[model samples]
Target: MNLRLMAALGAALMAGPALAAGGAEILKSQCVSCHAVEKPANTSFERLWERKGPDLYYAGSKFNKAWLEKWLQNPERIRPAGELYSRHVKGSDKEDVVDESTMTPHVKLSKADAEAVAAELMKLAAPEGMVEKGAFKGEKVSMSMGAMFFNKLRGCAACHSAKAGTGGASGPELYTAGERLQSDYIYSYIKNPQKIDPHVWMPTLNLAEPDLQRLTGYILQLSASEGK
Candidate 1:
């Protein structure tokens, strides 16, 4: 569940190459409101904006640009399956407020401007400052510890996933949290999830800093590369 484990998982998700420093500034300013390059771990999205979307902190690393440009032109249902794993389970009665119409469109932007923004966003990296080698504590998390953390302590699987038959279905599936998210952003979100989403459907439980780290570690271990 430490940083290394998560990085390992995310690395596998990098199926294709990536390029940064294109004209993503406009994209950042325009699309970043909901798709922030941040995290949401410890707070609910409701307190942050009364409405918020998932973070784009690792867009460059996780998604393909062809898909992104197409998305800008006409978004597909990425989050429609729900952030955690809506495709797998039944979500609450409340429907998501975000719809295709609410997304920012590039129609107003000149073709060049839209492309530039898309280029910049394609360069983004997951905010990882802690997934360095030798970052985990001397002791690895025992299965008991991992199990307890997953089910009892952090219970991240609720909105997240680990190995299936666990976690939540309200957010993105966590079966690959390691490769998908930047660790530093995860840390930041755990410290203050409210900063990312003011109106997140998730609840905000007061988790201690160290506990958050443990939870992050556990979540990261669910990365995609371990078996790959």
Candidate 2:
């Protein structure tokens, strides 16, 4: 994978909701500064970072439990361009002073605490009751529509990739999008981009609920989910 593209994907992943159960209070104290428990709109990334954290409203919908646990225990060396605690760079640093009035301290996670938090965190649910079970016909229609949506409406290819026929400077490459995202995750993102980044270039256009569904369906199907 390309370095810049990976960076874009890494940054994009940061936009999702995080699951940390026993860590819930930790979330309440340390994480909620950016994430909105109620809905995704309140949590555009840029907006949340302002208070010193990224919005984790969609954690239930986005992260892998094990990865999140490890991340909490030892945050990755890689830092998102505008991360709230970038000044410290990694989990060991103490220089990143969080304003108590705005953000909370980065308390270390205990094994039991991390597991409990991960279990609860994974339950983050979205209202997709209307979406029928079983995969929709994708391959062609989905890929094409996803491309169109990314370029014209959502403009995801921007910042993420140029092949979508539009261009952005900051995001990642979707060249193999089919190989990356899960359908459930993609659909939820289209419904609300703010959950990922309350203020990233990705905007929350007032797309009709159904249209949002289709967009997500298409994106989830953007890459093949098998034989990675």
Candidate 3:
């Protein structure tokens, strides 16, 4: 099935009550204050501090439908510090003394609202083939190898945390990435983050194909272990 059509189907299949409750109007009133449905004209990390929330311009391309539905109803802190990490402080000692005022929890949605919103967000699309099938499905990497690449080789630990409630607070925690993200999306983003979010804080690393496959496989392994 064409992925874009999935969004439409989501809305159509919503429990009748959720469909009856205006989804678009609910999104506009509750979500637009923070998230952007369309691509923003600007794409500069320098101006990232001004962003109220993460862009959902290509959300349909980026997120897993099941994950999105579940997350909408039970939102969690993806970014530990804040949307603009520089503005929030955790100190050099890695203390948990972050100023809580800098961050606000996502607006909690009722099951009906979450269903409607997830449906609407899923409708947001990107260019075709952004994540080709089996793109990131490659050779498996041992946990140790994945750890070495993530922590030492790629220096990803500087921003992203490999485990929940651990590592740097600047980026989203990858502890549950495999559970939350689609492998093809992960591979495509790693290959060219700029293609995904041009002004994203994550750098564009021209990692070799082998390294990319290893990293992708590693995250999947990590998530499965966590699930156990």
Candidate 2 lDDT tens digits, 1-228: 999999999877764444322366665775565555545544444454455544445556565676567656755322222344343233325633323343234556777666776666667654454222333333334556656776777666545543443354334334433334345555545555544444544566777755656665554454343112
TM-score-better candidate, 1 vs 2: 1
Q: What is candidate 3's lDDT per residue for 1-228, written digit by digit as tens? A: 888799888777885555576667688888887887777777776656677887787777777777777888899887887776667766656665567877778888788778877777778876686665578766778899899999999988888888776678878888778877878888888888777766777888899988889988887778888632
Candidate 3, residue 118: lDDT: 75
TM-scores for all candidates: the values are 0.48, 0.45, 0.82
| Model 2 lowest lDDT segment of ten | 76-85
lDDT of 3: 0.78
Deviation in Å, model 1, residue 59 alpha carbon: 6.9
At residue 49, candidate 1 shows an lDDT of 43
* Root-mean-square deviation of Cα positions for candidate 3 versus the true structure, in angstroms: 8.5
How much does candidate 1 score in TM-score? 0.48
TM-score between model 2 and native: 0.45
After aligning candidate 3 to the native by TM-score, how far in Å is the CA of 183 from where it should be?
1.4
**Residue pairs whose backbone atoms clash in candidate 3:** none
After the best TM-score superposition of candidate 3, give how far the Cα of residue 66 lies from its true spot, in angstroms. Answer: 1.5
Global CA lDDT of candidate 2, please? 0.51
Off by over 4 Å in 3: 1-18, 45-47, 90-97, 129-133
